[model samples]
Target: MLVYVVDHNGQPLMPTTRGAFVRIALKEGRAKVTRTKPFTIQLLYETTSFTQPLSGGTDPGRTNIGEAVLDAGGEVLYNAHITTRNEEIPDLMAERKAHRQASRRGERKVRQRRAIKNGTITFPLEKERTPRGCEKPIVNKYIRNSEARFVNRKRPANWLTPTTNQLVETHLNAVKDICRLLPVSDWILEINRFAFMRMEDGSILGADFQNGRLKGYPSVNAYIFALQGGCCACCGKPLIEHYHHIVPRHLGGSDGPENIAGLCNECHGKVHTGKLSLDKLGKAKKYAALSVLNQAIPFIYDGLVELFGQEHVHICFGWQTSEQRKRLGLGKTHDADAVCIASLGNGSQPRQIPEPYEIKQFRRHNRAIINNQRERTYKLGKETVAKNRKPRFEQRGHSLESFLKSLSPVWRLDACQVMEVSKSTRYYNSEGRCMPGTVFYRCRRKTPGFIHGDIRRQGPSYGIMPFVCLHIILMQASRRGVMPT
Candidate 1:
């Protein structure tokens, strides 16, 4: 294992593989541990800034990032496969949106009740006026009818979706963090620009730009209907309207013309319910991964240039990386691709093939204070009757009574996920023996409660064990150097 080192002034120097030297320095109070998981130390005494020229190579990806630092002589210094949080962002954003909407509705309800009490409005649904030419009457004058502010909104030239932006940020932050650890003078990034149109049809000429896949067709459904000869694929029923997917959207299916099959309503329902099958419908075209990669590549390259300077940062295409990796007899992986990217200009093979660092990026801070554990008692066509329940006791063998009995006088139930607080990080060696430096407490909670880092000694006294707090050393250890405060 390589130990990254820094000077007395906290500036990063060359990393050392000498474990005994590092141990001696620590024992003699010459250096102190700065970070773990790519273990780093800062020296107490001043040191010279002389260092070897190191170049970094990164395989930019939507979900996983490959990072590697190499010396001038093709020596792999620092290598890591960083798992990004891009996939989780969308779901979290959707949940946040739902929460915000619910909060706004609750606030509006409270305001309406207050207005009714103060005689500002008679009742919650009391109508004040109706706009001309509008069929629906305007109810509740107290309810604010805000103007369309979205019309005046302006986006910058380089604007990306939240997920893509987060992904790009992850790449940038990963590079920045690595730079802080090692002296990276230049960077080589592996990127790909997909020609989606060419991939679909190689025969497509320049004139085909004017005429798209759905040029004459009004909609995709209409196009599919025409493609299927206006009849159901399973049953030859005329006047087919419903569009059936050969492969479901959830199962990596695209809504392209090839993936779509025209079917009657009954046939569509039958296909969905597995009562019937359409063998004529070929296959589903999946371009989601490719599309995401294509969209993110430019942004990632631009960010790299801005960080490492235009002269220092060099771009290598995906094909070059693949060719080199194949010639080097390396297996296809993110880390291997990164190594290939680094060894591009140099003819010699990488000498130092150390075990690469495996680093997974964590979600910075969870904004969710409460786990909305709602169980639906009854579900009709459009209505669902749900009862709010404690998140922890929902599982078998966990109960509120047991939790209450275990709780101390100082302890109170706060809204948070029980799993997070109870989670303990225990590192193990290659022989599967548990090592030291476990961060969170292994406090197994009987019932769900909030995760407050402030509960230091409260867990042990009550036999619950110390729970992992979010704002404590956990955040610093995990999410450091990613986002600025």
Candidate 2:
């Protein structure tokens, strides 16, 4: 019974008797050992002595000696003086260890090769540097371009050949010559036509040539040339001109020469000012004629105010100015309206509610107050005017009460299963501790009137109580066939 200590690979690191004692000591923490073999164990004792067989026969002295030594309290010395030969043990352990080492080396080599192939393992291009007080080398990696490039060292793929380049240049020069044949205004008109050209035959050149023909007409040429010179067509006034279309595009008029006309700036202004009856031209041509005039005017401010209302026109102008500032890389600061609270009643009491009889009387008073406040604000500083104003809750007038009462008749409906708002609960855990829970709600209504209208705010706010109000109005109106007279 020879004892041996081996590593994961079954390599013997120590011989029998001494190895057993060392193993026990290692287990007891009195000694320590490391092995690449799979086995780790402790032995109770080690000695060399003879033992009799159960059949009453004496065993071989050498074979029984190992067991006898283990049975005794005396420690067996695995010294050079006492040697036992076991040729296979060393050979077997050596073979196993070699096989395992080869396997590990092969695995490591495969990983390294893979890394190199994938470019993960790359040689550093930058020089190594050490910190001011440190001796360690600091490795740095090289940065490369992210864009894809061809492997060829010659010109880029999209670069034109010398022959193609010459051909393009020749064609471009020809086009320029043809463009020069036309006046500047005609050139602009041709370009506009080219920009908006639509294909009839689903062919590119056909559409472009067709549009060019239309733009090159004598009538169009005369109109555009006169327009470019800023001469009014109605009176031949050189002050300014407006391009008025005979048939308005919005009313289904084409961009044909026969559909276009010109007007004096004054006449155009009068038309939009409602002094002239545009209805005389028919609704179809009215908008188209207006559009043409708008385009011809040089002053954008006046033209925009004429088209959209003053409020919307101002907003558009503000947006345009903002965009221009951004393009020029300039910052803008605008003063915003400030919010202030004013108390109308005494600090102790709620605001008074006007009686039914006093409603008409208070109406006059309220209008007067509002008018005075406006006038005062115009005369005084903003801060002073705000300080002077008071916030008063007005009584609900008969009209307002009637409006509320009308709403009471409308029914409120819960979301149907098909369009219900779904909710989910979630629990979180971190670092072996349970965290707080949370609930998430998702609304799934897609159609209009799923919610009420009057109280409903459009857009994102439509999903709340306002939605319910809107839905009620829609349902009630549909049921009663009540036109909103």
Candidate 3:
């Protein structure tokens, strides 16, 4: 394990695993421990500072983000995989809302005595029409009594869902921390954009070329044409190049890059006239999830440039990083991909990948009870706390000696004597009623589930995967270190 160090001013220094150097510094009182979790320390005495050019690579995902920093020599320095709580946030929020609603329902009682003092005789009444088409007075028992919502709301411009915002924030914060800890001169973000279905068909239109939902492309067309080596796609001829839709427009085919291709007029005519088939043209299916994440590219780019300066940050497609990892024969992982991105400018030198420490964003358990958490019931019908229960005991009042005293001078005291309970002395509540030595009987009381120690386990029919259904199988597989073979 390497111990992270910082200068007197808290600026980061290269990590060191040299035990003697650290021990000497601590023994000489030159350094003081700063953080125990990561075992980091800061130098108390001034020290000369030296840092090398480093690049930061970030592999952002929906659930986990991988970060890695590499020096100019292509050495892995820092590696971490931060698991985010994107999905949990919403669930927590829902729980909080329920708690708040319970609070509004007047569940929490203060000091017990306060409840007695403030108990209301009746709820406020509201007049309303009844289902029988008659106006009648009714209690307004449904009052939220908390806060009134506006009842109408609108989403603000550039709005992002809570989960997405959290994800973006996680990525930004992870990147920011790395920048602060390392002398990051360049930032390489591996953002892979897939054409998905369009690319698989090989007929997709170029950005600068004529297109429909696929916008016009300037240099993107050059890349597409380069793929064909300036030769017509349909006819091997190098003359009279024209873009044509493989599938007819009336058939719901789009002008997407995968649906259009470079072809000679003769081939284009033949394709439109149904003399040629797109399937015969080698079209294949490609699956890619292209959505909000792709749009986040510009947003993330702007953020990086603002933090690291536009000149220091560079963008590389995810495929490029994947290719680098394949060439280096590195294991497939988020951290390995990050290393690939950082090594994009490192040339062809063989570099070792760093081991990543996983950081789980687990929900810390709160000792406080969740509000309005009702007990689960086997069979239910308005189960409530039964009040006015009479205590049952086999013996009369406390002890026989106390009962003897209550008698004679009170052989048979007035049956009108009511039990007077006082605060427990060395015991719980004790009343001077039940007139000593009177026989008692046993009465059974059923405690609510909330106070019970245990209950019978549910049968196998209940299953063990209630929560598991919420997880996407593919995502769970990825998290389990499994490759989709």
Q: For residues 108-192, what per-residue lDDT tens digits would candidate 1 score against the true structure? A: 7778778777877644455555455445665655654433335567999999988788888888888899988988888898868
Query: Candidate 1's C-alpha lDDT?
Result: 0.71
**TM per candidate:** 0.64, 0.18, 0.50
**Alpha-carbon error at 437 in model 2, in Å?**
29
Query: Per TM-score, what order, best first?
Result: 1, 3, 2
lDDT on C-alpha atoms for all candidate structures: 0.71, 0.32, 0.60
The residue-by-residue lDDT of candidate 2 on 1-485, one tens digit each, is 33344433332233344655665677786533442221233223343322211100000111010000111121221101111122123333455556666655545565666766677754664546554444466653332212222333478654543323332333223223222211111000000111223323345564465565446447664755454465654456765455666455544555554455456778788766877544434223223323322232223233334433354321213333344335434333220000000000001111221111100000111222222221111112222212112232552222223323433343212111122212222222223221122111223366565232322212344343323233445456567553221
lDDT of 3 by residue, 1-485 (tens): 67888899999888788989999999999998887646788999888888777788888776667788887777788888887776565556666666676655544232233534566422332323233322454333323122233434678887776656666677787788775566677787777665544654567667523453334435434545666777888668885467665664444344446666777888878876879766644332223113435655566767888888988888888778878888889888887777788778544343666568777665544312422233221111343211112222453233323433445665434311432322212222223222222222212226532212111122243322222222243344446543222
Worst 10 residues of 3 by lDDT: 450-459
Q: What is the lDDT of candidate 3?
A: 0.60
Displacement of residue 86 (Cα, Å) in model 3 is 2.3
Worst 10 residues of 1 by lDDT: 415-424
- Best TM-score among the predictions, by candidate number: 1
